[model samples]
Target: AQSVSQHNHHVILSEAASLELGCNYSYGGTVNLFWYVQYPGQHLQLLLKYFSGDPLVKGIKGFEAEFIKSKFSFNLRKPSVQWSDTAEYFCAVTAVSASKIIFGSGTRLSIRP
Candidate 1:
């Protein structure tokens, strides 16, 4: 079974606060991981990715994630989030043979100004 899950269906935060969203995947083999963000009134963008190498990968907009192989998890985090950071976050994974991606349900982050 290969699947991705996001624990937080929705999240709310005040401006300038730390943010963390949990993601878990069910897969037994090597895979590619990614985090995509969709900001309010904006298009979807790639936040980061983990194809290989370091487990701790950085992405755009001051966001980062650590891939834990043992736990089958890739959680997104930010030190301090702004109201502008408000968006819907998705965790995704893919196999070498699979051309398409497997996406988590999603996490909605609403940062209050």
Candidate 2:
């Protein structure tokens, strides 16, 4: 079984500020990591994902994440954030061949204009 952990529960940033959210997973074998964002009153949406090929994966809305196998981490990053970026971020992990996904508690991002 694989599990994910998000280091920060809440984050606050000003517009155009750089953002990074820590996400760590516990899985020895092949696994997939994903970052999902949920806006106010909206459903969860995929931000980025890491399955294979590249360790650094780019996603929608200028979001990206780097998968560091050695560190068991897949941290999300954005060079600049906007006020509209305010949302809840969730980190998830699953075995390559597994059907069940384990999600982190989630991190709430509050962006100031």
Candidate 3:
């Protein structure tokens, strides 16, 4: 079965800090990767995606992720983050199954002011 797993269920940080979350998938085929972020008080929004071109993709609000086929993972990373970046992050993957995407549970990010 195709599945995605997130490393942390919740993360806490100060107003200004760096953030890195792990995301792993169980599949060995052509895939489309995505990272969706839901702000503290907002709906879900796309952070980034890896379709076919570059393995390194950058997204809104200074967020990015790298797709490592060997590791079967696509990890999200941010050098510096702000309180506004506090949100619930979910990693999703779409394979050739022609079915819906497989999304990891999620990682809740909390930024303390």
- Predicted structure with the largest TM-score when compared to the true one: 2
How many residue pairs of model 3 clash at the backbone? 0
In model 1, where do residues sit more than 4 Å from their true spots? none
Model 1 clashing residue pairs (backbone): none
Candidate 1, residue 72: lDDT: 95
Compare candidates 2 and 3 on lDDT and give the better one.
Answer: 2
How does model 1 score by TM-score? 0.96
Candidate 2 error regions (>4 Å) = none
Ranking by lDDT: 2, 1, 3
Q: Report the CA-based lDDT of candidate 3 relative to the real structure.
A: 0.91
lDDT (Cα, tens digit) per residue for candidate 3, span 1-113 = 78999989999988668888999999878899999998877898999999888899999889999999999989999988888887899999999655798999999998898
User: Whole-model Cα lDDT per candidate?
Assistant: 0.94, 0.95, 0.91
Backbone atom clashes (below 3 Å) for every candidate:
0, 0, 0
Q: After best superposition, candidate 1 residue 9: deviation in angstroms? A: 0.6
Please report the candidate that would top lDDT against the real structure.
Answer: 2
With a 3 Å backbone cut-off (N, CA, C), the pairs that clash in candidate 3 are none
True-structure RMSD, every candidate: 0.9, 0.7, 1.2
